[model samples]
Target: MSKYFAVLLLLIFSTQIQALEKVTLQLKWTHQFQFAGYYMAKEKGFYQEEGLDVIIVPADPNNPNVDFRVLYGQAQFGVFHSGLLKQRLEGKPFVALAALLQSSPYCWMVKAQSGIYVPRDFQGKRISLLGHTENGELLMMLQRAGVNTDSMLLYSGKKPFDDFIAGKFDAMQVYSTNEPYQAQQLGVATREICPKQFGLNVYADVLFTTEAMLRDRPQQVMRFRRASLKGWRYAMLHLEESLAVTKANYATHKSLAQLAYEAEKLKDFIRVSGIPIGKMSAAKWLWIAQLYHLDVSQFHEHKADFIYSEVKQDPASLSWVLIIAAVLTLVCIPMYIQLIFSRKNKSHLR
Candidate 1:
């Protein structure tokens, strides 16, 4: 009886040990090099090795608010712009798990020969602006730089790349990665005016999760974070492999050379940030909150203590621990019941 009971316990424990955890990750944007780390992690089996089944969902531009909606409860984790996350943290119960890009990738681009020397040059000139939080940041930047944002004619539209190339606007707020690379590919002479150059340093991409998840499933969060950080480290070290993974995910840009360029550019941006990957500083958070005029007090109240500064354990080893613990728990349960029954019988005999 004891041998059968032990075998039964072992089988149950083994089944529990092999149980897979499912996690869905929401990307901030469509498939691009910006999210190459996650793709690399999936491709390299980092998540699987960590005992996680991760689904990476690319965000739809048409549904701009989809990330927040999914993150509120629908998804276990979400990739988002730190600025957007900062604003949402004011009222929403969300906490940033890690900072992906240490620096903002936003910049103003102009024709190389335009000789537009300074922000003052943008005054009274036509400028392309994307309507959203970026527009607000640009407005603030221009105000600080003594540029009359209202004096300039604003071309509010999507994919301002074509319009800028057609000489529709003197300059446009373009992603330092995509638009600039696309322009160079077309042989368009352009120069990037980094927002950081104009004192508009903001944190860009971040990994975030709801406060509820952080509290209820902290180990899961740690596992995901460790796996993601490992993926990023691998991507940075194995650049060519990461690019191949990116190409596989975004099939439209079928050119390997283009994919390589995109990957190299992302690597450069990451290097220039000076901060190591996955490190989010308190000062950066404070600056973002101040820039957005959000009430930081609200965030402090709910999530001040829950933010994970670093991974507490090796993600790769957590699964084994869970498996062992589950096995021990299963084995001990029946033994405890039997011991209780034997004790009761002895008492009755007495």
Candidate 2:
């Protein structure tokens, strides 16, 4: 009876130990190749291996605010653009974990026949930035090129892309990886005035979480980062497989061919000059801060805590400790039970 009881207790402890920690990841946009790494992570058991059950929440177009979701604790982690630096400077306790895109995918798209080859050419033109009120990179690019952003006629209305296709706007902001391919499918010959071309490059699709999570659950943050980056490496290497996983599950809205195009364009951004995917440098962040005209001294002050550092703890050590505790409990409990039985028997015999 004692042996069975011990076994039951061990089973209960094992069940408790095997239970995974649940966490939510808020995406910056709808399910697509842009978030393929996260999809692959969940699909390939990377998160499971890290003892995590990650709930990937795709952004609703009506409520597309990844930063808010994470800040308010609706999600533990989120993906955002370099605008994250702007938020950080605003006293938000956010920490950047990884920057998946070494180069910003944003660019200004114009009809090839429009003769607008550069940012300077955008002066006095009707521009639509997909209804975005804040895009510092593009505005900075135009500003540097001597174009008054206020001088340009800005369109803020529904279906900006359709309006651009209809020749209602001279130029519109676009994702080099996504919109260009979309335009190609529609047989629209378009040219992109990418910020990178003018040497105003910045990071995109940065994985981040609030500093509280990093402080309170450091191990979980490290595990999630490890698994997420591993998933990104795998997705980069096996693009076709990742695309299949994304389409079959997360991004049924995107066609394989379109995903393939996005993957192709994203390769340079993801794997820049053999630099490891998701690696970030303080120098780069500071440069981005300078571009945003934020207080560089403030960034310098908080950067130590803003960037991620690995928590040096062995993943298997905790498991070993738990196993040892279970084994000790199993043995000691039965022995104690046997001792109790012996005492009771002696009393009865007496």
Candidate 3:
């Protein structure tokens, strides 16, 4: 009977230990090559190795307020712009865990033969922009190039790339990773002008979580970060495997050439020194704060630390710090009880 009871207890404890830690990650956009690293991680069992079961939720265009949704605890983590994070962290508390892209991929592209060699050519031209943010960035870039945005006609909508190829717009703001590669695969030669060339360097695709999660479940966050960084490093190193994983996820957009081009571009973007993969710096945070016109003083007051520099450290340190502290307490607890009992006996004798 004693042997059976012991075996039953061990089984119960083993079952409890194998129960996976649940985490939810919200992507900034729909499934595409941009998020190939995360997909590769899931497909390759990296998250499982870290004892995590990660669920990736796609962002809804209709309900675009992922920041508030994440803040209210609808999700555990999210991928978004540092600008949006700066704005969201004003009153609400959130921490940036890692930056996927070292630099913004925002760029204006035109057909190579369109005679639109420079931004000045954009004056008196029609341009297609996806949203107001892209339009604003393009306008800023144009202004720097001495091209007045008022002089150009703006067409804003989500439409086919063929629209630009058919002379609908003289230029368009497309991701340096996506549309440009798609155009190249279609034999549509394009000239891309990165917005950063004009001194507009915004941080793109930042990973973040709520303050509550950080405080209450630091171990879970650490595990997730380590797994994600491993996934990112693998994706960066194994380009073909990463693209294969992405293609499996987004089978509708089939163009091996385009995927290859995007993978190469993204690799370059992620390799920049200032933008270490899965890390964030205080200087970058301050720069983002300034860009969004946020008060830096407020951040200094409630300052939440989210950057994980030790995310890639050895697995032993990944163990729960609180667990170690508890063990130390348990060891000292017996000595404390003995001291109390000894004092009580001496007082009774007196």
TM-score of each: 0.81, 0.86, 0.76
Residue 52's lDDT within candidate 1 is: 83
> Per-residue CA lDDT of candidate 2, range 1-350, in tens?
66766776777667655777899999988988988888888899999877789999999878776698899999999999888888888899999999999888888999999999988898889988544423568888999999988777888879888888999889888888788898999999998998888898699899999999998888889989999999999999899999999889988988899988988888888988868999999999999999888899999998998888777885643864586677778777877898899999999999
Which number leads on TM-score?
2
lDDT of 3 by residue, 1-350 (tens): 35544655565445435656788888887666777778777788888766678898877767655777678888898887755555545556777788888678888888898888766778888887556342345566677789877767877756747788777787888788878877876888899877677676667788878779877777777777778878888888888888887877663466766677777787776777655686667777776666555787865654445444434454434454444455546645765687799899999999
lDDT of 1 at 341: 97
Ranking by lDDT: 2, 1, 3
Model 3, C-alpha of 217: deviation from truth (Å): 1.5
Of candidate 1, the 10-residue stretch with the lowest lDDT total is 298-307
Off by over 4 Å in 3: 1-17, 61-65, 118-121, 130-136, 157-160, 249-255, 296-350
Worst 10 residues of 2 by lDDT: 127-136
Please give the distance, in angstroms, between residue 143's alpha carbon in candidate 3 and its true position after superposition: 3.3
Ranked by TM-score from best down, the candidates are 2, 1, 3
